[model samples]
Target: MLRATSLSIVLLALCACGSRAPAPQAAGVAAPDARGPTANAGNHAFQAAITADDFAAHVQALASDGFAGRGPGGIGEDRTIEYIKAQFARIGLQPGNGGDWFQTVPMVETTADESAVLGLKVGQTVQQLTFGDDMVVGTRTGQARVSLQDSPLVFVGYGVDAPERDWNDYAGIDVRGKTVVMLVNDPGFHSGDARLFDGERMTWYGRWAYKFEEAARKGAAAALIIHDTAGASYGWDVVRNSWSGPQYDLPAKDDPAPRLPVQGWISGEAADALFKAAGQDLAKLRAAAGRRGFRAVPLEASASLQLASRSVEKHSRNVLGLLPGSDAPDEAIVYMAHWDHLGTHEGGTGDAVYNGAVDNATGVAGILEIAEALRAAPKPPKRSVLFLAVTLEESGLLGSKYYVAHPVIPLAQTVAVINLDAMAPVGKAHDITVVGKGSSQLEDLLKVAADRQKRRLVEESHPAAGYYFRSDHFNFAKAGVPALYIGSGSDLVEGGIAAGEAASRDYNEHRYHKPGDQYDPTTWKLEGIVQDLEAVRSIGETLASSGQWPNWREGSPFRAARDAMRAASVGSR
Candidate 1:
């Protein structure tokens, strides 16, 4: 659901957490307050409020062709946000942002000219690579015409500069005014060494966004990532398709992290060719790059590319609806889902719209259902609940990023964030998949809730793909707010794990990101998603009622940030 990413592989390999009976509390973990009168009342009301028919109805409408795929900065966005706003109002939610239901997100959209080819000159052997086949390039400079003339090419392995981990790919290398090429994922992945940067689990450093940011920080003129299916977790087609369309970003003023004049991905074959021309073996160099103290390799090749692009400044809205608490109104629990998908492809042959039914229409509908349950409860939560339907998630999570920067409630006061994205439609399951498990105490509460439902919590099967970092919750996690993102388990109650895996594989191969991702009433089974929503509601209700603030785990990268923020708040008080 997070742009061109897919979780079918992870789902296919899902393993059960053993027994289906109510699980006992693990050693030293506190049992959740599951038996509280208020919680029970809320749970009972939740079951009544959240219905499969209602969820299916919402998804059907949102993913219908009339919404035109819910693209931001288009007619689809207008209809989509208004539908969400109308639903919130119907459910008795107050406008969240200063009496306004929408928060304006300023964006810069750049559509590159796909006809432009990447020119490479390795010692007078000029190789003109075709776009969309050999490589795909774009610029974030917001300039009309971007041109580079024979810049020196350097291979900065992974392009990571992490002093805390004592791994610096750019160490002792001056890549200023040159084009730097890097490998996807991190050294730990290729090396299979647990000692290097979280091993298979991708750190933020492994993300392509981070690679470009680090490249820009090192004064590189341009950056290119070598695309491999294993490292990138998707095929070259995904890279091409995702990068081909109009790319959106927060305005330079709003997001001042860094920018790249040119950034894109090249196929593995293209990389091998370039390396061979430069008198280097890509495989050997890739192996060397994974080792500690690996220096930057000078390719002895120069690269040139001219990207001509059309740019536009536009504004999209983040739809917010609030259910105010009776007591602690300032404190809040946030449930969010992106309300955008790949818009209609104009001038295309057939089936242009990418109706994101399971991709995120399901998620949006999920929040709406959860909102109804919360509002229907006999006793309201002590802390407020905010239902946020954000935009531009397909374009690098710009909406959530902006909300984190400019929140209606302060991050210190915000309790936790629960994100729902791409809920599977494969019926009921015996378990639920917790993305980025063991990151926070929220999972402890989730486990308790699962146990109550005769279900168990299982970690994502593929950690190397970095599924945790791919969604909207990652932004909240970066800001030190404990966040939880759970997926429907692959072990179906009726047909078991094999059937679930088959369903996931079918979706991955045929419908994911394609026009076929439409809502189908005949085939879709909403029982599993309903269960997932119930579990999420339980977590939110628990946190909202209690004064307890869930914190990141002891060894998590986010723990320090949470500790600092809490300490500062206390000192200020």
Candidate 2:
């Protein structure tokens, strides 16, 4: 259950690459590359052909200068689109986008001026938090001016409203016309008990985005999350840089909910200061927020913010390719990976490009490799396979949202989605993390494959980060398609814990969404990546072969949708 830093994980990779391989293998056995299959004593020749070198070439090309860091809607996306389309073509994957390889995702890019000021009021202290340094705020509302005044802030612990679980943070209070400041994750996180809210595996309700939405649903004018290193999973620098750039999001015309007038995060220190000013102890308030009938506490701090906004209509593309099944071409299996990063951060590093070598180039390459393997398989699958390289994932899961809305195949027939994001190119680890573990039956299929590889299955270390909802896969999950967005674990097979933890920590500080995240052949090992990819491919194979369609667990929100679809299909038959 212990979690390692990103750097430690990377170091684990480095040490593993330097070390020797496990157990003897016969000659000509292929080692796992970035593709899904691993090398052992008797790997098929087809498996060996798609070796580590194949993985390396794809990643290097995707991260290279020609792609310009693959920023969505930029020249970068153009190059990325062409490159992926070509790879799908080479693998004999026909276009999935209604005979087209590209799916248009229209986005509204907004830039709030750096000069924007958030005037904060606590007691008599009037603190002005600058936009980029102290905090960053953006409004998805298509408006020229954004404003919130005399909005009383409330600490609504987690801002979760689940009637099914008998938990409501706003049980006794009316948050309408007020601002609700909340914690980042679910309560079970601090409790560590599996009885509450899927324990460490984040539910959609635990996501900060959901918190903001719930606040808006409760008629609150604004929402803010208290930032903690453990809770949010990223540092303030990540927040600053990620939000500071041009923000990409789908047009709001499709959404029916009212937008939060002001949404942002308050640093831990700043949040503590505010709690003290309101004569309420921060720890006590946090504790109370986790209770079953927690009431929103009035911090009585009003806020006034003025941001200069600029907007543009930008279009990104989702590369879609299909491998029709031998028996059931209409039913599809989707493999999705985000193909965009922060692009070139001006003047941030000596090298401007945030190449995102491991953040997602590795993920995109995995898809290409898997597509080739599926193409080379002895017989086509009964269900078709969809290889998707979506855009604006770093910004949001926008490209995927667009695809689901305009899917070439009906959403009901889409069997499953296996999302590979930020695959670790480090050494082989002892575990593979299934992030949204209990959402569907996919976890069992993965466990079977991982066990065969002598690897353990681990839950996500930072579930409060809402990693399930954070990536492109969330779009599919929300659309009633069973989804999997697993991660490469930080437990090293050879070098052990210290080395694994170090690699993860280093990545957060040095490479994550930064210029230094370029292709690092000297440091990375594709062994772990191959293990994860194969696990995904195995799951896809499982779904393709099984006549029975898997559904979400009994209590899942998606269960009703799946049932309804199944009933209609039965009626038609």
Model number with the top TM-score: 1
The TM-score values for the models, in the order shown, are 0.92, 0.88
Model 1, range 371-462, lDDT digits (tens) per residue? 99999899999999999999878888789999999999999989999998888887888888888778899999899889988898877766
lDDT (Cα, tens digit) per residue for candidate 2, span 458-487: 766555556666777778777788887776
Residue 554: error of model 2 in Å?
A: 3.8
| lDDT, candidates in the order shown | 0.82, 0.72
The C-alpha stretches of model 1 lying farther than 4 A from their native spots are 1-48
How many residue pairs clash in each candidate at the backbone level? 0, 27
Q: How many angstroms is residue 478 displaced in model 1 relative to the true structure, after the best TM-score fit?
A: 0.6
Ten-residue region with minimum lDDT total, candidate 1? 14-23
Native RMSD of candidate 1 (Å)? 9.8
Collision pairs in model 1: none
